[model samples]
Target chain A: MEAFVTLDAVAVPLPLPNIDTDQIIPARYLSRPREVNHADFLFHDARRVPATDEQNPEFPLNREAWREAKIIVAGKNFACGSSREAAVWALFDAGFRCAIAPSFGDIFRNNGTKNGLLPVVLPAEVVEDILAQLEASPGAHIHVDLPKQEVTAPDGSTHGFEIDPFAKHCMLNGLDDFGVTAAYEDDIAAFERRYGRENRI
Target chain B: MSEPSGPRTLFEKIWSRHRVTEREDGQTLLYVGRHLLHDGGATAFDVLRQRGLKPRAPDRIFATPDHYVSTAGRKLAEIEDPRHREMVEKLARNTAEHGIRMFGLGDPNQGIVHVMGPETGLSQPGLLIVCGDSHTSTHGAVGALAFGIGSTEVAHVLATQTLWQRKPKTMRITVDGTLGPQVTGKDVILAIIARIGAAGATGHVIEYAGSAIRGLSMEGRLTLCNMSIEAGGRAGMVAPDETTYAYLHGRPYAPQGAEWDQAVMHWRELPSDAGAVFDTEVSLDGSAIQPMVTWGNSPEDALPIDAAVPDPESAADAERRAQMRRMLDYMGLVPGTPLTDIAIDRVFIGSCTNSRIEDLRAAAAVADGRKVAEGVLAWVVPGSEPVKRQAEAEGLHEVFRRAGFEWREPGCSMCLGTNGDIARPGQRVASTSNRNFMGRQGPGARTHLLSPAMAAAAAVTGRFADVRRLVGG
Candidate 1:
């Protein structure tokens, strides 16, 4: 779980807005064992026809540019509905290191931060600029340097994204909920010893 | 950092008693007393298997299968989606493999997990409960500490009988006075959310107390807790009483004669001491609550059953005004349109939230002498096979069928668009289920959350209407 927090590539061209958990990974995949390869389940249904057995030929991911794209630029309200952590597991496992959106679902945002996924909130027009760059030059990448607190898309364009200070502090240090608690484990022990079992429900 | 607080709400009482200790960060390591299981638990089971672990407290675990499968007609084995069918079969097989107690498919004790917990007494006061489903908090009605967890956290509980959590602040909601006849527990919860606004209880656990809540049946209390998330609280709970004790007297998991005596003594001690404390206190009058309806994408976007859609211009808050305008446009509801004037294409009276035998009986009471509107596609699904069988024996199913409502299999059908039973886009559906979020039913579909009785009456009238009209007529 060690994290570099160093800037990697970024895809400025955002994906469609209001991306739902089901669209990230269909509900059918929810029944599978969590250890199963959930990454493959992402966009499984959207790639295929709703009523028919055929796959959509022009879906974005089907395009060559997105074959190995690790950074996803998405529209507003991404990761909305159902606090399924598998949604985060899928995006993280799929090699997506960062997601830039105007707005994000509360649960998904919290889960993303806890799981080491950096979520960058930027204005819509700023995101559209990156999309234009990606569209103009396929396979374009943006640098999202966590330590530097900056993002540089492939076209050498610079953008400043907002990250909650508390969350940023945790991700760069690879601290999970327990890891954070361990910092105060000594204080917790001292309190318990002093209070005896009165506090133990 | 403690709130300007005094006199613990039931939530504070449980939190202080359960608190192992607060760590340096905003995290708490409290002991979990019980963990309920359900059909949608296969993912957690898989995680446990991968880690070579089993449930640490076998006695504390409970399970049922009412999702991704069904029990009305020949639905036990007939599954349209192979994915859903396999999930149910796997859940049943794995529960057996784990040697954990299970109310599996066809078991009379089996039903919606939340519905059966209170009925059978598994959900008791002063206990901590967790499950793989978000609605698990519905068990908090017995003054228990209950909340949902991710599969990973579920695995942590299975392996160690505990979970790593950041304790939320406590909010005390005092609901006094008696409710109006039409203001059921569902209405009470809706009304609370409407007043508090959607995110009012963010980062908090709610303690519900008052004569109004105490008077609700175990089934109704579960309904109240089930929708706590709609208010952004981690969970909601009610203290135990004679009704709680009576509900748990003789059930499969409840303690045996001597053990039961000891357990009840402890459960009795679960209430807040005369002088405890809470972080925040909010009081409301239940008598003022009315049958309510959600008119927007979020649950908070609601009004009393008799009220008209609000005009955005009348909103004092800018964000609320924008949201109101958006809701009006999306729902195709004019600002001044009366809620009763809205037409509905479908009526669904079943889900984990509602659809218990009691819920069914309530709906049937409204459906007794009426027939479903010809244009309405109405369906009644019991929470479990046992509920369906019981309702059939009591002729509740017949009552619905006679009224032209289709009595279908038990899986989580329209509650989520999971099992292939979804309303078409643009159709308005009155659902006795949770979550009326956009596209929650199906793409472009509109959903109105209501009680089973309300759903039944709506089915007959082909619009959102009051159930008391049919019930009292």
Candidate 2:
């Protein structure tokens, strides 16, 4: 995991709600090994024309100005279905370090945190303001400062966000749950020694 | 620290038991009681290897090959797709290397991870269960606190047998009154999703209670809990009762003899006490729920079978109306078309949501002597090899085959378009599987989520038909 403190990058606006994992990275791409570049399959069904194999012109990702955006501003309940972490990996693989939405699927949100992909929850109105700003100026950049727990808009106005303090701590230190659990190995070994005698697998 | 007391919800009791330590920041480290792994386990195993770690408590982990295994009756070596074959092979290799027990493909104990857990008694009241699939809430039917986690979390559990967590608020969903004869558990859940939008239960662990819920069989309870994730719930639970105990009394992994008596004594005390207050409360009338089916590309876009497709103009908000229009366009459905009259190209009667033996029996009764409509591609995939054998022993397979439906092996076939089983492009399918998102069954495939009986009825009629009417009940 990479430590995430602050990111200043162009924000892409995808205003649709309930963009589920199936749409993020289809199940068809799930069989491949972890090393496969999953970014290519991100929104495979929605982004490409099935008949012509060309990028769908209507999709915001296909717009030239938003092509390189590193932060995604989406509608409510983004990444809503399935527990596939491929969704987060695909976003990270595609160079998106942050996604701001009104809400997110529980597992998707957790997966993002574990992978250092910051999923920032904001009020719907605040998200709308961000999207509005992005629409007004296609390549506008937003700054997210994890240490400060604030998001600064292109106009220099700042909005506060809430994240679990432990999650924030882990993100700042590039730590994972495994690393945190390793700290208690002595206690775990003690419990296992006492409990293992009774229940043998 | 002192205990705050009034009455605790079931979720609170179970969460407290599993809590190992808590930080001032409101995050707790929870000791996982059991971990369920499926073929997706391979990916997490790859991560473990990358980190140069071994499973800390391999005894606590159980693995199975469900998602990527071919359910077309082919031997493991004969799997057509090399990628799918490699996934199953990797799972076998990893589980073996870790010395973890696996109910591999063709193992009688093997089935959909959710179905196999409770059937084998690996799930129990008061335990905290985690799996890599969203439908893991199915195990909560046994009164356990279970929810889906991502692969990274799976690897974390492999390394520590614990999860870092913030406790979720509790919601109580009370369904009262008796269901009509034709209605099943699937209808109950669909009705709940219809009443509450997909995200209505977000950030909450829902504890289902009330008369109707208590009246359901263990399988029905599982069905209700299985789809809780679809409604954005972190987990779904039903308090342990006689029904829960009877189901776990003698299963392979259940406590036995004196231990069993002691376990029941503890489980009997697991239900929420009177006057317990939930963060949110929702109640539904069971009798009013009909044989339900989804009309658009969301589980929440559901209606009674007799109802017509919704008109976007009737939506309360412009954004919802636009969403309705887009979903309708993708589903190729017209507003006001009677749900029963809409045609279907396929009928799938399997998935964690509706693949138990009871589900198979219900579908078999519908397809008993009826011939499937020409051009309809129908399949009945059992939940597990044991379920498959039980259905065969009861001749349920014969009924489905006689009705022109293909009787297949146990796996998640045609559920999410894996392992070469998928509805063709532009095809509309009536599926017992949970989700109906666009391309969920296959690219350009339209899915109308329904119960097994409704799916079987569609197989015979070539369109969505009221199961009650088909059976003349």
Judged by TM-score, which candidate is best?
2
Q: Which pairs clash in the backbone of model 2?
A: none
Candidate 1: tens digits of C-alpha lDDT, residues A130-200: 77778788778778888777888777778877675656777888765544444554655554455434212
Q: Sort candidate 1 into its docking category.
A: incorrect
Roughly what TM-score does model 1 have, to 2 decimal places? Answer: 0.80
lDDT values, one for every candidate: 0.73, 0.89
Reference-based lDDT, residue A143, model 2: 97
Give the native contact fraction of candidate 1.
0.16
Count of clashes, each model: 13, 0
- For residues B268-367, what per-residue lDDT tens digits would candidate 2 score against the true structure? 8889988999999999999898999999887998999999999999999766898899899999889989987899899999999999999999999999
At residue B432, candidate 1 shows an lDDT of: 86
Question: Judged by lDDT against the true structure, how good is candidate 2?
Answer: 0.89
